[model samples]
Target: MCGSTVERFFRGISEFIFHTKLGVADVQLVDYVSDLMLRFVRVDSLYSLRQSDGMRTKHVVQMISEAERRIGLAKREVYRHVGDFTLFWSGMYPESLSAKKNRGESPDQLIDYCRQGKRAYAIAAEIEGGADRPSSELIHRMSEHFEMCAYGLREVRRHWEEDDDSNGLLTW
Candidate 1:
């Protein structure tokens, strides 16, 4: 299969694993994806801007557009993964547990939720690596994805903190 297609397939598998009953393995996947997403965003931003400068002569506007699309798609995927993970964790605790009612679920449950989310992230990172065009298009998409991931991560972190401390910020 083509690199892009292969990447997509792997990404889908990762998403599946995250949504499934995977365990701590998913956390490792998320960490991997997070690092890759950051790297792709940085590299793609610089690359796309540089390539855009020569678009007049290279007539590569289409390429740039495609790259932007890829970035947008990737970003959305990452956001969804993070959001889902946050929600899952939030469901395990109370919005305002009294000291007597604050026992909450075990740490293992929280870890499992995080692991599944991370697995989904790993898939996205793998697909992001499929862009071999090395043009401005790829860079633009990476930058977009990076921004989305950043936002999603913050949201996820907030949810985790609120859930753990019964702050109600992440309550549904």
Candidate 2:
């Protein structure tokens, strides 16, 4: 059942890429997201193994931990780029990037917001930690969120490509 679900998720992602106007930046983001998905699938599979054969559950746990580390790194990288671009596109200097316009707050004050996003990603990565009694609802929600991110990236790339084409800009 789990294997089939994973396969279906990958198929959906591929179909989305084929039907959407994916661009270089979007493709890059998709690659990162895809890597994360693959890692999750691996962790899930290992977890399933633990249920039928408890002998190697420890190994599965270790694998999940490693996958979590990788996911965390990827999340950090994504946020770093996203934050930089957010500041640039908004015409805000680095010092003012996190400032709250209405509240007159500094970027430091928004650290919790960033942490919340990263925590979501971290939780997704560790979704299989309790495989023996994993929450199916949570897994489904994570999968949906992953797909949404992929689709959003594709749309962003499509718009960027269109903008470049209209201006005769050589993105290559």
Q: Which stretches of candidate 2 lie over 4 Å from their true place?
A: 1-25, 44-115, 118-172
| lDDT (10s digit) by residue, model 2, range 2-66 | 45655555434543653353433344345444434444445443233222333333222232333
Runs of candidate 1 with Cα error greater than 4 angstroms are 1-24, 36-49, 54-156, 159-172
TM-score of each: 0.21, 0.24
Score candidate 2 by TM-score against the native. 0.24
Best by lDDT: 2
